[model samples]
Target: MTNTNSTKTIAVYGATGHTGGYLLAELRRRELTPVLVGRDADRLRTAATAADLADADIRVASLDDHDALVAAFRDADVVISSLPAYVDHGEAVLSAAIDADAHYTDLSGEQLFVRRVFEDYSARAEAAGITLVPAVTDSNLPGDLLGHLTSRRVDGAAEITISHHSRSGGDGSRGSAETVLASVDWFREGGWHYADSGWQTGRPPVAELRYPTEQPRPASKFPLTPVLTIPRHSAVSSVTGLLPTEFHEGLKKLTADVVAALPATPDPASDLHYDLVVDAEGSGKSVRGVLSGLDSYRDSALMAVEAAVRLAENTTKPGALAAAEAFDATDFLDALAPHGITWRIEEL
Candidate 1:
């Protein structure tokens, strides 16, 4: 709660989206200035007004307008890409942030987009002397950090198994709904996992999990984004990610009609909780790390903002990086405790 600053400015692209509203408020709550940047002038103005960011800057910039996008980010210490579908509309913003000399982070959870940032932008970001951290939301960040911790418990991690368990109190944001619906094609393919010394597709060697009081249940073999993220910074030989079978089916069920019926932004009354767990085993020992928090979308904003603020300090690893590589995993995780996030590691 003591992390407040008004001197540093953060430009938020897609400031009118469902998560954007929460992101803006968090920035202002920290006393950091927010620059509302997006394609729609009217919508940006409304979001700025709602956040009570009267003295904040509002720059209208479309992703395609490279010059405009660069100009929009020129005055900021860090840029938070708040877009719903990063795979579809992420590159331009990332590229522009590099051109503008601004540190960058985003709310991306898509495996493809996160991987793209690493493969395509790593060298460019290093050359620009700016950090680009993709997919630092509840999905990837916690697991990556926790996986690192869990791996450290043993001699080294031969493999790490990750899982996502989420609870939403009511109908969530329409943007989330639309994004999931749009991503149905490849999202279910269960993106790449590292094994046999390299990335692989199809069935992965995932260990059966019995987290805490819960029993091992049928989980859908889906892309656990950390599968792509963890190996980047950790010394793990293999990584696997999955979700509960019911959650996978629910993702398939999110139709356009259902998205239309959802709220434009997260309802203030509804509660959200997320738990990301990683089990790493090697050298005849096993350790598990769990990171839990409330309000998925809102806490995601906190994660992105924290990443941005940390990147602004210029202490993170330079270049496109995973959450663990971007910051001191233990320290960053500890800083989030005041925000209802609790984390721990234990040996079995």
Candidate 2:
């Protein structure tokens, strides 16, 4: 890890988006200057100003413009990409990070994209001695924390399940909406599944467990954090993911209506608060952890920011990584405690 006083700079791509806005604020709060990069000049300027980072430089570039992206990354000690998970754009961002020879991190959950990077970019990043961490936010962090907690009790875990719940109030950002839509299309095509080969189709529902709550919400299958994290962690043989079936059905209903009313602005009435519960089981016993909070997008940005700052300070290893592999899991979770994000654990 590098010293805080080194005056090194970090660049944030997609700086004009909602999560990017919060990320910029976090950087400013830490007295770190972050270069804001986005396709929209006006929005970038506005976001930079809003973060009280008027002195920070704003660069205009899109994923299609390879040269501009490379230029934007040049000289950056670290590059934090809050870019939405568009298949094409995601690859371009990774290319830019490689071109710049800077450490890279992003909030992405696209399984295909993640696999490509792991297979293709991992060696490149290692050769450059720069880190490339994907799924740095909500998708993977909670499960990683759960894995860490479970390891203390058992030698290995056989299966794990993760579930998410959010209040229906806050609106999704443009980026989030796009990512969700893409994921929906992917799932519709049976693009994700678990198999003996790992994350393949034809695997049946792992299990249906009731969330330990007064409401006893039922969870449905979803592809997000666990699909990627479980395979990465050798302690676990397999992982399955779920979301409240009611929440999934509710979202499906809203998406149907929204699709019918295309070209019109999305209705914000369906937004809500969110929560997550993760359970891990092994040969002898099991452990469960719950993390409940508000504003999923904001929380994700906060997580990314804290992790990015830690990366900039060289508080973690310098090579290809993920949230659990790069940052100190316990320290990261402890930091979130002051932000109204609480985690409770139990042994069963």
Candidate 3:
């Protein structure tokens, strides 16, 4: 990790959003400087002030202007995007980062976008010698890494199931709301899951999920980003992600008007709890890995910033990668322990 005087620069895209504020604060806390790059100059300045980085470099670049985005990241060693709805607005920054010769990571949870990053940009990123890792948030990071760890424990998993559970003190931030609303059509349809041959949509019966001390509940198969990520680096033939079926039903009814009425950000005291459970089974044995954390948004920031810092060290292989593919699964998960995020693997 770079200290106060280190010359490594991290460029943060979407520096004006709610999660952007957390990313900037985390970068500052780690004694690394952030170059705020976003579409709005005034909002960037405000975010800078709020992060106590009033003197930090600020670059104004809209996503539409590819050249401008490239210029904004020209001096950055790594670019970490905290933008919401990556399915709608991720490629520009990703393209720009490769153009600027900077490694990239983002807090994307969109399966479509995550798939595109690897399929569309993997060759370009590899040719550019820069890493591009998407879906590094609480939603997918733990699941992907844990999928890697638990699968190995069973000597190679033939089937892997990931379950997601989240608790928030209130409605989440506007960005999260927007992400859900924007992707509801696909999300509610039981987005892509890996099967024996390839990616498939609408796989089977509702997923049966077992949380701690609770009876199995039926969870809808959701577009968990890891379904796309894990297959890239792991040998899992089947991967399924489970979320509350009710959540998908609710999204079936969500509308722009309803989302517009939401608050722009989470309250100062609003607490968030997230659990990512991975069940790997094969060879008449099973391994379960549970990754639990507090504050999805805050922990996501930590995950992205840590990815940037680690990528800045230039040790990971360059190309479109998953969190586990880029770093040691066990070491990376263990590193998050101090941040109120923990992972444990046990025989079942």
Compared with the true structure, all predictions reach lDDT values of 0.81, 0.69, 0.85
Candidate 2: count of backbone clashes, pairs at least 3 residues apart or interchain: 13
lDDT of 3 at 119: 89
lDDT of 3 at 86: 84
Tens digit of lDDT per residue, candidate 1, span 1-348? 111354677889988876888898988899877888988888888988899988778788898899999988887888999887778889999999999988899988887788899899999999888888888788688988898788888886557888877666225678776666667766666777788778787876454556566788776567757888777777898898877766667776777788888877777766577678888889898888988888788788889988888887766767988888878899999999999899988887
Give the true-structure RMSD of model 2. Answer: 3.3
* TM-score of predicted structure 3: 0.95
lDDT per residue, candidate 2, 1-348, as tens digits?
122467778889988777788788888887888888878889889988898997988888888899999898887878888876545478787778778877788887666677777778888877776788777666467666666565555555556677666555224555565566656655433345444647764435644555666466655666665566555654666666766565456455446445444432224465545667777777877877777655676677788877766776665555567666776667788788777877778887
The lDDT leader among the candidates is: 3
Which runs in model 3 stand beyond 4 Å of their true positions?
A: 1-6, 267-270
- Itemize residue pairs with steric clashes in candidate 1: 5-31, 272-295
Rank candidates by TM-score, best first: 3, 1, 2
lDDT of 2: 0.69
Q: After superposition, how far is residue 60 of candidate 3 from its true place, in Å?
A: 0.8
Residue 161 lDDT, candidate 1, scale 0-100 = 85
Q: Which stretches of candidate 1 lie over 4 Å from their true place?
A: 1-6, 169-171, 205-208, 266-271
**What shift in Å separates residue 37 of candidate 2 from its native position after superposition?**
0.9
What is the TM-score (0 to 1) of candidate 2?
0.87
Write one digit per residue (lDDT tens) for candidate 3, span 132-175.
88899886988899988888887654588888777652358888
